[model samples]
Target: MSAVGPLDAALTVPAPAVVEPGAYARLRELVAGGGAVALTGAGMSTASGIPDYRGPDGTRRVQPMQHGEFVGSAAARQRYWARAYVGWTRFASARPNPAHRAVADLERLGLVRHVITQNVDGLHQQAGSHRVLELHGTLDRVVCLDCGEVTTRDQVQEWLADANPGFLVAVDATSPVRPDGDVALPEAQVQAFRPPLCLVCGRDRLKPDVVFFGGSVDKGVVERAYTFVEQARVLLVLGSSLQVMSGYRFVRRAAREGIPVAVVTRGGTRGDAETTVGVDALVGDVLPALVADLRG
Candidate 1:
Protein backbone atom coordinates (compact mmCIF):
# COMPACT_ATOMS: atom_id res chain seq x y z
CA MET A 1 0.00 0.00 0.00
CA SER A 2 1.11 3.53 -0.71
CA ALA A 3 1.22 6.45 1.76
CA VAL A 4 -0.90 9.41 0.61
CA GLY A 5 -2.77 12.59 1.50
CA PRO A 6 -5.96 14.32 0.23
CA LEU A 7 -6.68 14.35 -3.47
CA ASP A 8 -5.90 17.50 -5.45
CA ALA A 9 -9.00 17.25 -7.63
CA ALA A 10 -12.59 16.74 -6.44
CA LEU A 11 -16.14 16.86 -7.81
CA THR A 12 -17.27 19.27 -5.01
CA VAL A 13 -20.91 18.39 -4.48
CA PRO A 14 -22.67 20.52 -1.92
CA ALA A 15 -23.34 18.86 1.44
CA PRO A 16 -26.93 17.66 1.36
CA ALA A 17 -29.62 17.14 3.95
CA VAL A 18 -30.15 13.97 5.97
CA VAL A 19 -31.91 12.44 2.96
CA GLU A 20 -31.56 14.67 -0.03
CA PRO A 21 -33.67 13.52 -2.95
CA GLY A 22 -31.19 14.55 -5.64
CA ALA A 23 -28.19 12.91 -3.99
CA TYR A 24 -30.19 9.78 -3.26
CA ALA A 25 -31.27 9.63 -6.89
CA ARG A 26 -27.67 9.86 -8.08
CA LEU A 27 -26.59 7.22 -5.53
CA ARG A 28 -29.37 4.90 -6.66
CA GLU A 29 -28.45 5.34 -10.31
CA LEU A 30 -24.75 4.61 -9.66
CA VAL A 31 -25.42 1.34 -7.83
CA ALA A 32 -28.32 0.34 -10.09
CA GLY A 33 -26.08 -2.17 -11.78
CA GLY A 34 -23.92 -4.85 -10.15
CA GLY A 35 -20.20 -4.20 -9.45
CA ALA A 36 -20.16 -1.67 -6.61
CA VAL A 37 -17.94 -2.21 -3.56
CA ALA A 38 -19.01 -0.82 -0.17
CA LEU A 39 -16.24 0.65 1.95
CA THR A 40 -17.47 1.32 5.48
CA GLY A 41 -16.24 2.77 8.77
CA ALA A 42 -17.19 3.45 12.43
CA GLY A 43 -20.21 5.53 11.45
CA MET A 44 -21.77 2.36 10.07
CA SER A 45 -21.75 0.80 13.56
CA THR A 46 -22.95 3.86 15.48
CA ALA A 47 -26.56 2.89 14.83
CA SER A 48 -25.79 -0.42 16.57
CA GLY A 49 -24.85 1.54 19.71
CA ILE A 50 -21.14 1.61 18.96
CA PRO A 51 -19.51 5.06 19.01
CA ASP A 52 -17.09 6.43 16.43
CA TYR A 53 -13.72 8.12 16.93
CA ARG A 54 -14.95 11.44 15.58
CA GLY A 55 -18.05 13.56 16.07
CA PRO A 56 -20.45 14.63 13.30
CA ASP A 57 -18.28 17.72 12.76
CA GLY A 58 -15.25 15.49 12.00
CA THR A 59 -13.20 16.32 15.11
CA ARG A 60 -11.62 13.38 16.92
CA ARG A 61 -13.04 12.77 20.38
CA VAL A 62 -10.27 10.60 21.73
CA GLN A 63 -6.68 9.68 21.05
CA PRO A 64 -6.43 6.03 20.03
CA MET A 65 -3.69 3.68 21.30
CA GLN A 66 -0.77 3.42 18.87
CA HIS A 67 0.76 0.08 17.78
CA GLY A 68 4.27 1.07 18.76
CA GLU A 69 3.24 1.93 22.31
CA PHE A 70 1.27 -1.27 22.77
CA VAL A 71 4.14 -3.41 21.53
CA GLY A 72 6.97 -1.51 23.20
CA SER A 73 5.56 -0.79 26.65
CA ALA A 74 4.29 -3.42 29.07
CA ALA A 75 2.30 -0.74 30.87
CA ALA A 76 0.47 0.15 27.64
CA ARG A 77 -0.59 -3.44 27.13
CA GLN A 78 -1.90 -3.69 30.70
CA ARG A 79 -3.99 -0.54 30.33
CA TYR A 80 -5.34 -1.71 26.95
CA TRP A 81 -6.49 -5.11 28.22
CA ALA A 82 -8.10 -3.57 31.28
CA ARG A 83 -10.18 -1.15 29.26
CA ALA A 84 -10.85 -3.71 26.54
CA TYR A 85 -12.01 -6.35 29.01
CA VAL A 86 -14.63 -4.00 30.34
CA GLY A 87 -15.61 -2.53 26.98
CA TRP A 88 -15.91 -5.89 25.22
CA THR A 89 -19.22 -6.61 26.90
CA ARG A 90 -20.87 -3.59 25.30
CA PHE A 91 -19.00 -3.84 21.99
CA ALA A 92 -19.83 -7.49 21.56
CA SER A 93 -23.50 -6.83 22.15
CA ALA A 94 -23.77 -4.32 19.27
CA ARG A 95 -26.18 -5.63 16.65
CA PRO A 96 -26.23 -4.92 12.90
CA ASN A 97 -28.60 -2.06 12.06
CA PRO A 98 -30.73 -0.98 9.09
CA ALA A 99 -27.74 0.26 7.08
CA HIS A 100 -26.04 -3.10 7.41
CA ARG A 101 -29.18 -4.86 6.29
CA ALA A 102 -29.57 -2.46 3.38
CA VAL A 103 -26.02 -3.11 2.27
CA ALA A 104 -26.71 -6.84 2.43
CA ASP A 105 -29.88 -6.28 0.45
CA LEU A 106 -27.82 -4.48 -2.18
CA GLU A 107 -25.63 -7.56 -2.50
CA ARG A 108 -28.67 -9.83 -2.76
CA LEU A 109 -30.00 -7.55 -5.50
CA GLY A 110 -26.60 -7.99 -7.23
CA LEU A 111 -25.77 -4.29 -6.96
CA VAL A 112 -22.88 -4.50 -4.53
CA ARG A 113 -20.23 -7.06 -5.33
CA HIS A 114 -18.01 -6.84 -2.25
CA VAL A 115 -17.63 -5.05 1.08
CA ILE A 116 -14.31 -3.69 2.35
CA THR A 117 -14.61 -2.15 5.77
CA GLN A 118 -12.23 -0.18 7.99
CA ASN A 119 -14.27 -1.22 11.01
CA VAL A 120 -12.91 -4.14 13.03
CA ASP A 121 -16.44 -5.07 14.05
CA GLY A 122 -17.81 -8.11 12.20
CA LEU A 123 -21.26 -6.64 11.70
CA HIS A 124 -21.11 -6.85 7.89
CA GLN A 125 -20.65 -10.62 7.97
CA GLN A 126 -23.23 -10.85 10.72
CA ALA A 127 -25.56 -8.87 8.46
CA GLY A 128 -25.17 -11.54 5.73
CA SER A 129 -22.57 -9.96 3.44
CA HIS A 130 -20.68 -13.01 2.18
CA ARG A 131 -18.13 -11.09 0.06
CA VAL A 132 -16.68 -9.10 2.93
CA LEU A 133 -13.06 -8.15 3.54
CA GLU A 134 -11.74 -6.65 6.75
CA LEU A 135 -9.07 -4.01 6.11
CA HIS A 136 -7.89 -3.56 9.72
CA GLY A 137 -8.63 -7.07 11.03
CA THR A 138 -11.20 -8.18 13.60
CA LEU A 139 -11.29 -8.04 17.40
CA ASP A 140 -12.86 -11.48 17.81
CA ARG A 141 -9.39 -13.11 17.87
CA VAL A 142 -6.13 -12.74 19.78
CA VAL A 143 -2.57 -13.27 18.59
CA CYS A 144 0.51 -14.21 20.57
CA LEU A 145 3.36 -11.90 19.53
CA ASP A 146 5.98 -14.25 20.95
CA CYS A 147 4.95 -17.61 19.49
CA GLY A 148 2.76 -16.20 16.67
CA GLU A 149 -0.07 -18.52 17.63
CA VAL A 150 -3.60 -17.27 17.19
CA THR A 151 -6.44 -17.92 19.61
CA THR A 152 -10.01 -16.86 20.21
CA ARG A 153 -10.67 -13.67 22.13
CA ASP A 154 -13.12 -15.59 24.27
CA GLN A 155 -10.28 -17.62 25.74
CA VAL A 156 -8.30 -14.51 26.60
CA GLN A 157 -11.36 -13.01 28.26
CA GLU A 158 -11.69 -16.10 30.37
CA TRP A 159 -8.07 -15.82 31.48
CA LEU A 160 -8.56 -12.17 32.34
CA ALA A 161 -11.65 -13.01 34.36
CA ASP A 162 -9.69 -15.59 36.32
CA ALA A 163 -6.70 -13.38 36.99
CA ASN A 164 -8.64 -10.24 37.92
CA PRO A 165 -11.68 -11.26 39.83
CA GLY A 166 -14.25 -8.48 40.28
CA PHE A 167 -12.29 -6.15 37.98
CA LEU A 168 -15.26 -5.50 35.69
CA VAL A 169 -17.55 -4.76 38.57
CA ALA A 170 -15.20 -2.10 39.87
CA VAL A 171 -14.95 -0.23 36.55
CA ASP A 172 -17.37 2.63 35.89
CA ALA A 173 -19.66 1.68 33.04
CA THR A 174 -20.10 5.33 32.04
CA SER A 175 -16.50 5.63 30.92
CA PRO A 176 -16.30 6.65 27.25
CA VAL A 177 -15.67 3.82 24.78
CA ARG A 178 -13.20 4.42 21.96
CA PRO A 179 -13.53 3.35 18.32
CA ASP A 180 -10.97 0.58 18.99
CA GLY A 181 -13.45 -1.14 21.40
CA ASP A 182 -11.80 0.04 24.61
CA VAL A 183 -12.97 2.50 27.24
CA ALA A 184 -11.35 5.22 29.31
CA LEU A 185 -10.51 4.47 32.94
CA PRO A 186 -8.62 6.03 35.76
CA GLU A 187 -4.89 5.24 36.00
CA ALA A 188 -5.45 3.53 39.35
CA GLN A 189 -8.02 1.16 37.84
CA VAL A 190 -5.82 0.54 34.80
CA GLN A 191 -2.83 -0.20 37.05
CA ALA A 192 -4.79 -2.58 39.27
CA PHE A 193 -5.95 -4.56 36.26
CA ARG A 194 -3.90 -7.64 35.31
CA PRO A 195 -3.40 -8.32 31.58
CA PRO A 196 -3.93 -11.76 30.12
CA LEU A 197 -1.14 -14.05 28.98
CA CYS A 198 -0.92 -16.08 25.78
CA LEU A 199 -2.13 -19.67 26.27
CA VAL A 200 0.26 -21.16 23.70
CA CYS A 201 3.45 -19.40 24.73
CA GLY A 202 2.50 -18.57 28.33
CA ARG A 203 3.87 -15.12 27.57
CA ASP A 204 2.45 -11.66 28.33
CA ARG A 205 2.41 -10.54 24.69
CA LEU A 206 -1.16 -11.30 23.69
CA LYS A 207 -2.55 -8.64 21.38
CA PRO A 208 -5.95 -8.23 19.79
CA ASP A 209 -6.01 -9.27 16.12
CA VAL A 210 -6.40 -5.68 14.90
CA VAL A 211 -4.30 -3.04 13.16
CA PHE A 212 -3.65 -0.29 15.62
CA PHE A 213 -2.83 3.30 14.61
CA GLY A 214 0.72 3.35 13.21
CA GLY A 215 0.36 -0.32 12.28
CA SER A 216 0.55 -1.60 8.69
CA VAL A 217 -2.12 -3.84 7.22
CA ASP A 218 -0.99 -7.11 5.62
CA LYS A 219 0.08 -6.68 1.98
CA GLY A 220 -2.12 -9.51 0.76
CA VAL A 221 -5.20 -7.95 2.29
CA VAL A 222 -4.38 -4.58 0.73
CA GLU A 223 -3.85 -6.22 -2.66
CA ARG A 224 -7.20 -7.97 -2.45
CA ALA A 225 -9.00 -4.71 -1.59
CA TYR A 226 -7.24 -3.00 -4.49
CA THR A 227 -8.36 -5.70 -6.87
CA PHE A 228 -11.97 -5.35 -5.70
CA VAL A 229 -11.90 -1.60 -6.35
CA GLU A 230 -10.12 -2.03 -9.64
CA GLN A 231 -12.89 -4.26 -10.91
CA ALA A 232 -15.74 -2.20 -9.50
CA ARG A 233 -17.99 0.07 -11.57
CA VAL A 234 -18.78 2.25 -8.61
CA LEU A 235 -17.10 2.56 -5.22
CA LEU A 236 -19.85 3.17 -2.65
CA VAL A 237 -18.44 4.50 0.62
CA LEU A 238 -20.75 4.40 3.64
CA GLY A 239 -20.35 6.28 6.91
CA SER A 240 -16.60 6.83 6.62
CA SER A 241 -14.68 10.05 7.06
CA LEU A 242 -11.87 8.66 4.91
CA GLN A 243 -9.54 10.53 7.24
CA VAL A 244 -6.87 7.85 7.15
CA MET A 245 -5.21 6.66 3.94
CA SER A 246 -6.08 3.02 4.57
CA GLY A 247 -9.63 3.49 3.26
CA TYR A 248 -8.91 6.72 1.46
CA ARG A 249 -6.49 5.01 -0.90
CA PHE A 250 -9.33 2.92 -2.31
CA VAL A 251 -11.34 6.08 -2.97
CA ARG A 252 -8.33 7.60 -4.67
CA ARG A 253 -7.93 4.46 -6.76
CA ALA A 254 -11.57 4.57 -7.84
CA ALA A 255 -11.24 8.22 -8.82
CA ARG A 256 -8.02 7.66 -10.75
CA GLU A 257 -9.52 4.71 -12.64
CA GLY A 258 -12.59 6.76 -13.66
CA ILE A 259 -14.88 4.58 -11.53
CA PRO A 260 -17.66 6.74 -10.08
CA VAL A 261 -17.19 7.23 -6.30
CA ALA A 262 -20.19 8.07 -4.12
CA VAL A 263 -19.88 8.96 -0.44
CA VAL A 264 -22.79 8.77 2.04
CA THR A 265 -21.70 9.88 5.47
CA ARG A 266 -22.43 12.35 8.21
CA GLY A 267 -20.16 15.42 8.26
CA GLY A 268 -17.29 15.99 5.81
CA THR A 269 -14.83 13.47 4.42
CA ARG A 270 -11.26 13.79 3.24
CA GLY A 271 -12.34 12.25 -0.06
CA ASP A 272 -15.31 14.58 -0.50
CA ALA A 273 -13.67 16.41 -3.38
CA GLU A 274 -12.91 13.14 -5.16
CA THR A 275 -16.49 11.85 -4.89
CA THR A 276 -18.76 11.69 -7.90
CA VAL A 277 -21.69 12.30 -5.56
CA GLY A 278 -21.29 13.41 -1.94
CA VAL A 279 -24.19 13.12 0.50
CA ASP A 280 -23.73 14.41 4.02
CA ALA A 281 -26.26 12.23 5.82
CA LEU A 282 -26.65 9.21 8.05
CA VAL A 283 -26.04 6.06 6.01
CA GLY A 284 -28.50 4.15 8.19
CA ASP A 285 -31.25 6.47 6.98
CA VAL A 286 -30.02 6.96 3.42
CA LEU A 287 -29.31 3.31 2.64
CA PRO A 288 -32.74 2.02 3.64
CA ALA A 289 -34.40 4.75 1.60
CA LEU A 290 -32.19 3.90 -1.36
CA VAL A 291 -33.15 0.25 -1.04
CA ALA A 292 -36.80 1.18 -0.99
CA ASP A 293 -36.40 3.40 -4.03
CA LEU A 294 -34.57 0.69 -5.92
CA ARG A 295 -37.25 -1.84 -5.10
CA GLY A 296 -39.93 0.51 -6.32
Candidate 2:
Protein backbone atom coordinates (compact mmCIF):
# COMPACT_ATOMS: atom_id res chain seq x y z
CA MET A 1 0.00 0.00 0.00
CA SER A 2 1.15 3.54 -0.72
CA ALA A 3 1.93 5.89 2.12
CA VAL A 4 -0.88 8.35 2.85
CA GLY A 5 0.17 11.99 3.22
CA PRO A 6 0.24 13.77 6.57
CA LEU A 7 -3.10 14.94 8.01
CA ASP A 8 -2.35 18.63 7.31
CA ALA A 9 -0.67 18.25 3.96
CA ALA A 10 -2.37 19.24 0.70
CA LEU A 11 -4.81 16.37 0.20
CA THR A 12 -8.46 15.83 -0.62
CA VAL A 13 -9.99 15.85 2.83
CA PRO A 14 -13.64 14.83 2.71
CA ALA A 15 -16.13 17.55 3.60
CA PRO A 16 -17.17 17.37 7.23
CA ALA A 17 -20.42 15.37 7.49
CA VAL A 18 -22.35 18.12 9.14
CA VAL A 19 -25.50 16.78 10.85
CA GLU A 20 -28.17 16.26 8.20
CA PRO A 21 -30.76 13.68 7.17
CA GLY A 22 -28.67 12.56 4.22
CA ALA A 23 -25.56 11.94 6.36
CA TYR A 24 -27.41 9.29 8.35
CA ALA A 25 -28.58 7.51 5.24
CA ARG A 26 -25.06 7.63 3.78
CA LEU A 27 -23.69 6.12 6.99
CA ARG A 28 -26.31 3.38 6.88
CA GLU A 29 -25.31 2.47 3.36
CA LEU A 30 -21.62 2.17 4.27
CA VAL A 31 -22.12 -0.41 7.05
CA ALA A 32 -25.29 -2.02 5.69
CA GLY A 33 -23.48 -5.04 4.28
CA GLY A 34 -21.70 -5.76 7.60
CA GLY A 35 -18.01 -6.69 8.20
CA ALA A 36 -17.26 -3.33 9.78
CA VAL A 37 -14.92 -2.78 12.75
CA ALA A 38 -15.92 -0.27 15.42
CA LEU A 39 -13.12 1.87 16.82
CA THR A 40 -14.45 3.62 19.91
CA GLY A 41 -13.20 6.18 22.39
CA ALA A 42 -14.28 8.01 25.56
CA GLY A 43 -17.26 9.69 23.86
CA MET A 44 -18.78 6.22 23.54
CA SER A 45 -19.27 6.24 27.32
CA THR A 46 -20.23 9.90 27.88
CA ALA A 47 -23.93 9.05 27.85
CA SER A 48 -23.26 6.55 30.64
CA GLY A 49 -22.34 9.46 32.97
CA ILE A 50 -18.60 9.28 32.37
CA PRO A 51 -16.94 12.52 31.21
CA ASP A 52 -14.52 12.37 28.33
CA TYR A 53 -11.08 14.00 28.56
CA ARG A 54 -11.94 16.39 25.74
CA GLY A 55 -14.90 18.50 24.72
CA PRO A 56 -16.95 18.43 21.48
CA ASP A 57 -14.41 20.77 19.87
CA GLY A 58 -11.64 18.23 20.37
CA THR A 59 -10.02 20.39 23.03
CA ARG A 60 -8.54 18.81 26.13
CA ARG A 61 -10.68 19.53 29.17
CA VAL A 62 -8.57 17.78 31.77
CA GLN A 63 -5.07 16.47 31.89
CA PRO A 64 -4.65 12.83 32.89
CA MET A 65 -1.90 11.40 35.10
CA GLN A 66 1.06 10.32 32.99
CA HIS A 67 2.49 6.82 33.41
CA GLY A 68 5.98 8.07 34.29
CA GLU A 69 4.64 10.42 36.93
CA PHE A 70 2.55 7.68 38.51
CA VAL A 71 5.39 5.12 38.47
CA GLY A 72 8.38 7.28 39.34
CA SER A 73 7.10 9.18 42.38
CA ALA A 74 5.43 7.90 45.49
CA ALA A 75 3.80 11.29 46.11
CA ALA A 76 2.19 11.27 42.66
CA ARG A 77 0.88 7.76 43.17
CA GLN A 78 -0.53 8.81 46.53
CA ARG A 79 -2.38 11.70 44.93
CA TYR A 80 -3.74 9.43 42.20
CA TRP A 81 -4.98 6.80 44.60
CA ALA A 82 -6.53 9.40 46.83
CA ARG A 83 -8.54 10.79 43.97
CA ALA A 84 -9.27 7.41 42.38
CA TYR A 85 -10.52 5.99 45.66
CA VAL A 86 -12.92 8.86 46.04
CA GLY A 87 -14.13 8.57 42.43
CA TRP A 88 -14.28 4.79 42.25
CA THR A 89 -17.95 4.36 43.12
CA ARG A 90 -19.21 6.74 40.45
CA PHE A 91 -16.92 5.31 37.83
CA ALA A 92 -17.77 1.71 38.60
CA SER A 93 -21.48 2.47 38.63
CA ALA A 94 -21.55 3.73 35.02
CA ARG A 95 -23.58 1.50 32.69
CA PRO A 96 -23.63 0.91 28.95
CA ASN A 97 -25.82 3.44 27.16
CA PRO A 98 -27.83 3.34 23.94
CA ALA A 99 -24.76 3.87 21.73
CA HIS A 100 -23.01 0.93 23.35
CA ARG A 101 -26.07 -1.26 23.06
CA ALA A 102 -26.45 -0.33 19.39
CA VAL A 103 -22.91 -1.45 18.71
CA ALA A 104 -23.75 -4.76 20.37
CA ASP A 105 -26.87 -4.99 18.24
CA LEU A 106 -24.83 -4.45 15.12
CA GLU A 107 -22.52 -7.24 16.21
CA ARG A 108 -25.48 -9.53 16.88
CA LEU A 109 -26.76 -8.84 13.37
CA GLY A 110 -23.28 -9.37 11.92
CA LEU A 111 -22.88 -5.75 10.84
CA VAL A 112 -19.81 -5.24 13.00
CA ARG A 113 -17.23 -8.02 13.08
CA HIS A 114 -14.85 -6.65 15.75
CA VAL A 115 -14.51 -3.76 18.16
CA ILE A 116 -11.24 -1.98 18.93
CA THR A 117 -11.71 0.47 21.73
CA GLN A 118 -9.44 3.06 23.31
CA ASN A 119 -11.63 3.16 26.40
CA VAL A 120 -10.72 1.31 29.60
CA ASP A 121 -14.28 1.27 30.97
CA GLY A 122 -15.14 -2.16 29.47
CA LEU A 123 -18.53 -0.83 28.43
CA HIS A 124 -18.42 -2.72 25.12
CA GLN A 125 -18.28 -6.09 26.81
CA GLN A 126 -21.01 -5.02 29.20
CA ALA A 127 -23.09 -4.01 26.15
CA GLY A 128 -22.69 -7.60 24.80
CA SER A 129 -19.99 -7.03 22.18
CA HIS A 130 -18.12 -10.35 22.24
CA ARG A 131 -15.14 -9.64 19.98
CA VAL A 132 -13.85 -6.52 21.76
CA LEU A 133 -10.16 -5.66 21.92
CA GLU A 134 -9.54 -3.18 24.70
CA LEU A 135 -6.49 -1.38 23.32
CA HIS A 136 -6.09 0.23 26.72
CA GLY A 137 -6.33 -2.33 29.49
CA THR A 138 -9.50 -2.32 31.59
CA LEU A 139 -9.68 -0.64 35.00
CA ASP A 140 -11.19 -3.64 36.77
CA ARG A 141 -7.79 -5.22 37.59
CA VAL A 142 -4.75 -4.14 39.56
CA VAL A 143 -1.19 -5.17 38.81
CA CYS A 144 1.76 -5.21 41.16
CA LEU A 145 4.80 -3.54 39.68
CA ASP A 146 7.27 -5.36 41.89
CA CYS A 147 5.93 -8.91 42.05
CA GLY A 148 3.80 -8.98 38.88
CA GLU A 149 0.77 -10.28 40.77
CA VAL A 150 -2.76 -9.37 39.75
CA THR A 151 -5.92 -8.56 41.72
CA THR A 152 -9.35 -7.07 41.15
CA ARG A 153 -10.24 -3.41 41.59
CA ASP A 154 -12.95 -4.29 44.11
CA GLN A 155 -10.47 -6.04 46.39
CA VAL A 156 -8.12 -3.07 46.18
CA GLN A 157 -10.99 -0.74 47.06
CA GLU A 158 -11.71 -2.82 50.15
CA TRP A 159 -8.05 -2.73 51.13
CA LEU A 160 -8.04 1.04 50.68
CA ALA A 161 -11.13 1.42 52.84
CA ASP A 162 -9.51 -0.69 55.56
CA ALA A 163 -6.30 1.34 55.35
CA ASN A 164 -8.04 4.69 55.57
CA PRO A 165 -11.22 4.73 57.60
CA GLY A 166 -13.80 7.50 57.00
CA PHE A 167 -11.62 8.98 54.26
CA LEU A 168 -14.24 8.72 51.53
CA VAL A 169 -16.87 10.46 53.61
CA ALA A 170 -14.65 13.46 54.15
CA VAL A 171 -13.93 14.22 50.48
CA ASP A 172 -16.25 16.50 48.51
CA ALA A 173 -18.53 14.22 46.53
CA THR A 174 -19.59 17.11 44.26
CA SER A 175 -16.22 17.24 42.55
CA PRO A 176 -16.69 15.77 39.10
CA VAL A 177 -14.92 12.55 38.29
CA ARG A 178 -12.62 12.41 35.25
CA PRO A 179 -12.89 9.64 32.71
CA ASP A 180 -9.91 7.91 34.28
CA GLY A 181 -11.72 7.65 37.63
CA ASP A 182 -9.91 10.57 39.26
CA VAL A 183 -11.40 13.43 41.22
CA ALA A 184 -9.89 16.67 42.39
CA LEU A 185 -9.34 17.05 46.11
CA PRO A 186 -7.53 19.26 48.58
CA GLU A 187 -3.85 18.52 49.14
CA ALA A 188 -4.45 17.90 52.83
CA GLN A 189 -6.97 15.20 52.02
CA VAL A 190 -4.57 13.43 49.66
CA GLN A 191 -1.76 13.55 52.23
CA ALA A 192 -4.02 11.93 54.83
CA PHE A 193 -4.92 9.07 52.44
CA ARG A 194 -3.09 5.78 51.91
CA PRO A 195 -2.63 3.85 48.65
CA PRO A 196 -3.48 0.16 48.26
CA LEU A 197 -0.82 -2.51 48.35
CA CYS A 198 -0.52 -5.69 46.31
CA LEU A 199 -2.58 -8.59 47.61
CA VAL A 200 0.05 -11.20 46.79
CA CYS A 201 3.28 -9.32 47.55
CA GLY A 202 1.99 -6.97 50.26
CA ARG A 203 3.88 -4.01 48.78
CA ASP A 204 2.78 -0.46 48.03
CA ARG A 205 3.47 -0.77 44.29
CA LEU A 206 0.09 -1.62 42.85
CA LYS A 207 -1.28 0.16 39.78
CA PRO A 208 -4.55 -0.06 37.91
CA ASP A 209 -4.51 -2.43 34.96
CA VAL A 210 -4.75 0.46 32.46
CA VAL A 211 -2.45 2.19 30.02
CA PHE A 212 -1.97 5.66 31.44
CA PHE A 213 -1.13 8.72 29.37
CA GLY A 214 2.44 8.52 28.03
CA GLY A 215 2.20 4.73 28.25
CA SER A 216 2.58 2.30 25.35
CA VAL A 217 -0.08 -0.35 24.76
CA ASP A 218 0.90 -4.00 24.88
CA LYS A 219 2.40 -4.87 21.44
CA GLY A 220 0.32 -7.99 21.00
CA VAL A 221 -2.96 -6.14 21.48
CA VAL A 222 -1.95 -3.51 18.93
CA GLU A 223 -1.07 -6.15 16.36
CA ARG A 224 -4.45 -7.79 16.77
CA ALA A 225 -6.21 -4.44 16.23
CA TYR A 226 -4.15 -3.90 13.10
CA THR A 227 -5.10 -7.32 11.77
CA PHE A 228 -8.78 -6.61 12.36
CA VAL A 229 -8.65 -3.29 10.50
CA GLU A 230 -6.74 -4.82 7.63
CA GLN A 231 -9.43 -7.42 7.04
CA ALA A 232 -12.46 -5.21 7.72
CA ARG A 233 -14.86 -4.26 4.91
CA VAL A 234 -15.43 -0.89 6.53
CA LEU A 235 -13.90 0.96 9.49
CA LEU A 236 -16.58 2.57 11.66
CA VAL A 237 -15.38 5.20 14.12
CA LEU A 238 -17.80 5.84 16.96
CA GLY A 239 -17.47 8.87 19.25
CA SER A 240 -13.71 9.37 18.88
CA SER A 241 -11.94 12.52 17.74
CA LEU A 242 -8.98 10.32 16.79
CA GLN A 243 -6.61 13.01 18.07
CA VAL A 244 -4.37 10.37 19.58
CA MET A 245 -2.49 8.30 17.03
CA SER A 246 -3.19 5.04 18.86
CA GLY A 247 -6.72 4.90 17.41
CA TYR A 248 -6.04 7.18 14.45
CA ARG A 249 -3.41 4.81 13.01
CA PHE A 250 -6.04 2.17 12.43
CA VAL A 251 -8.13 4.69 10.50
CA ARG A 252 -5.08 5.53 8.47
CA ARG A 253 -4.41 1.86 7.78
CA ALA A 254 -7.99 1.23 6.65
CA ALA A 255 -7.91 4.22 4.34
CA ARG A 256 -4.64 3.01 2.85
CA GLU A 257 -6.14 -0.40 2.23
CA GLY A 258 -9.05 1.19 0.28
CA ILE A 259 -11.66 0.17 2.85
CA PRO A 260 -14.53 2.53 3.51
CA VAL A 261 -14.02 4.66 6.64
CA ALA A 262 -17.12 6.18 8.24
CA VAL A 263 -16.97 8.36 11.33
CA VAL A 264 -19.94 8.97 13.64
CA THR A 265 -18.77 11.52 16.14
CA ARG A 266 -19.85 14.83 17.65
CA GLY A 267 -16.98 16.99 16.47
CA GLY A 268 -14.10 17.33 14.06
CA THR A 269 -11.54 14.52 14.03
CA ARG A 270 -7.99 14.13 12.84
CA GLY A 271 -9.00 11.45 10.32
CA ASP A 272 -11.34 13.65 8.25
CA ALA A 273 -9.04 13.58 5.25
CA GLU A 274 -9.20 9.81 4.96
CA THR A 275 -12.85 9.25 5.85
CA THR A 276 -15.27 7.94 3.24
CA VAL A 277 -18.18 9.37 5.19
CA GLY A 278 -18.34 11.44 8.37
CA VAL A 279 -21.42 11.92 10.53
CA ASP A 280 -21.34 14.80 12.98
CA ALA A 281 -24.05 13.71 15.38
CA LEU A 282 -24.55 12.13 18.74
CA VAL A 283 -23.62 8.47 18.54
CA GLY A 284 -26.56 7.65 20.83
CA ASP A 285 -28.99 8.68 18.09
CA VAL A 286 -27.08 7.74 14.97
CA LEU A 287 -26.18 4.19 15.94
CA PRO A 288 -29.70 3.12 16.92
CA ALA A 289 -31.07 4.62 13.70
CA LEU A 290 -28.40 2.84 11.66
CA VAL A 291 -29.09 -0.45 13.37
CA ALA A 292 -32.83 -0.05 12.77
CA ASP A 293 -32.42 0.87 9.13
CA LEU A 294 -30.04 -2.01 8.49
CA ARG A 295 -32.09 -4.55 10.44
CA GLY A 296 -35.17 -3.71 8.39
Model 2 over residues 69-143: C-alpha lDDT tens digits?
A: 999999998999999999999999999999999999989887789999999998899999999999999999999
| Candidate 1's TM-score | 0.93
**Model 1, stretches more than 4 Å misplaced?**
1-17
Clashing pairs in 1: 10-273
lDDT of 1 by residue, 1-296 (tens): 11112223332333235667677667766877668999999999998988888898889888998999999999999999999999998888888999999999888888889999999989999999999999999999999889999988888888899999998889898986678888988999999998988767788989999999999999999999999999998999999999989999999999999999999998889998799998888998788877765655
TM-score of each: 0.93, 0.93
Q: What is the C-alpha lDDT of each candidate?
A: 0.87, 0.87
Cα misplacement distance, residue 282 of candidate 2 (Å):
0.9
